[model samples]
Target: MIKKITCNNGLRIISEDISHVRSVAVGIWVQAGSRYELPQENGLTHFIEHMLFKGTATRSAKQIAEEFDRIGGNINAFTSKENTCYYAKVLDHHAKHAVEILADMFFNSLFDPNEIEKERLVVLEEINMVEDTPDDIVHEYLWREMYENNPLGSPILGTEETLNSFTKEMILSYMERHYTPDNVVISVAGNIQEGFLEYIESLFGQYKSVKKPVKSLETPAIKPIYTENFRETEQAHICIAYPGLSINADNIYSLVVLNNILGGSMSSRLFQEIREDKGLAYSIYSYHSSYEDTGVVVVYGGTSSNQLNELKTSIFDSIENVMNKGFTETEILNSKEQLKGNLLLSLESTNARMSRNGKNELLYGKHRTLDEVSETIDEVTLESVVDLAKEIFSHKPAISIIMPKKVDL
Candidate 1:
């Protein structure tokens, strides 16, 4: 079990003492991301995340990066649909340096106007880079059609137009409004000493308490719709998605198990039937993504141009069979075992644990261990998985297809 502590500013901290680990991970998390933005401010949160490392109160971006690497540490950050995280991993002896630097990056970033404009172009390039690749764009379309105008439906990297419109003032305001201590979490895992904790306390404990409480965010209404575009390409890529339960839903475990049976692994029904038996496509998989109040289950595949429609039909047929007939006892037993065995490899890194705990605390008010997660996965019976499949398939998932520019239907 990880130990939990609340800083003076109301920021929560979770720490785990792994008996003799050589490395440590420190992460800073805030309940701010694409889902937290207003329509006009859609991409500001992510923009601010980018600006954070450009410069802080006392360090330049290059210095921030180099100093960490100088100590044999690695650093990175990412913004998700529901949260933004900045983290560092280093030898256990360098824990103080990691937390101090992370604390500085978060609380004291300088939103330079010139830097903002430069980064604007940088992000624009990023958007362009993704558009240049079809695989990236198809996922965005799947989310858009599935969630429609809701925040959950929005892309974490934001759209080109929205990102271009982001300005320094917008980022500053967004950061001030959403990046509050009460909505933040700091997690450390490894060989941590009491002095390192004290140093962290000294660095972050002085942050001023946010004047406003974090009100619950309202998720957008479901927009069940289908969208299709004809693209000329040699290879056809497709993504089919449906509204699934959010993390807050009681049936989420069932959803996980249900996905395992659908296409989560090679032994999954979709992969075995679609790839091994029929040789319809080289790749086929189903996965689910969950946020605080929203979730989407998606099944994706790649096929020859002429087989796009056939591939689509095959997927729908497979889904319909699962929804109506459910999984066999063998499928359920194997999926459960596969899922449990996969859990151990997942916890090998402190960074993963840090990020995992930070987000869980923000959502569920506490952290759940791997054993607890496995138990929940095991407790998911075939009936429950079948029930979840029925409920999810009721929405009749939508599809997003990508293809080479030359192949015509």
Candidate 2:
């Protein structure tokens, strides 16, 4: 069963009880990320994530790690384009202790000046690591072309210039504005014991409620553009982007099914045609990235510099074939089953359940039962998938190519 309790301070507590499991997973989710940042604040949200573990008012970084080790619990955090989460998994008996430690870190982090200086170097090294990776850097270039002039297109890791300029004062000011009670959710899953709700409320309910006003953003129109970055590597990294559905769009299911058949797996058309049949590329795949108001579907692959043009032509041809002739009933059925199996298998994890609960609450403000989702996927018809293909593939893609420095285009 799933339950949600909203405290007097507007902090939400979402949980699920799986009595059979002997462990519990807890997460603190903040509705702040790169999308909530200004151009100058590109990476501050991620930086704050790193700093929270550095130390708190009463515990140094090593002591914090030691505490978790002593309890035989695991703790970590991650930042995305839309949110940040700090989570821990522990034996059910230690649930309260886990919450107490997490609360301490959240409410009393010191953000020491010396620690800030030290972490800056760590983050800078991270930025350099991404630049050194060509396959990773290519996707970053594609977003810049797809969402030109928009913060949505900015890299999650801000530039070296911005990281160097961030001070302790700057970091604190940003946190104060965004880390309000109403802007957070606490999600707990697995082995729900008695008084668990009361225990969480006791630790979190005392915070004063302050709601941050929502900011208005103008949605930038998508413009198709071609761009190429030259590097001294042996292979050419290429990506093509087409505008897709927003997070709430009704046609998202159709697009999901369509992506699977096209290039989502080894049996996908792009994989079978580009690599298996033609022997052109070693790695190829397709994926979608959706935000609150906009989204994009991208197909990416890497190949030798000499075969780059053939690879591009074959990708477009496969897309055009699907658009013109549409996919067969057998193809649609197989893809649907593949997607459903993947979704169902993922639910076997307590961590996956915790993540699903937290995300549904944060993004949609409600939860969908497993049956409800399976039914939605089952409702997708052959005509709907074909229509989605025509709608998506008809557009001329915005292409981003990265080729060897000395290779001719």
Q: List the candidates' TM-scores in order.
A: 0.95, 0.97
lDDT of 2: 0.87
Which parts of model 1 are misplaced by more than 4 Å?
A: 209-216, 231-233, 405-409
Give the per-residue lDDT of model 1 (tens digit) for 147-225. 7777777777777788778777787677767788888888888878768877877787777744464446777545656
Off by over 4 Å in 2: 209-213, 406-409
Error of 2 at 175 (Å): 1.7
Model 1, total clashes = 6
By TM-score, the best candidate is: 2
Predicted structure 2, TM vs. truth: 0.97
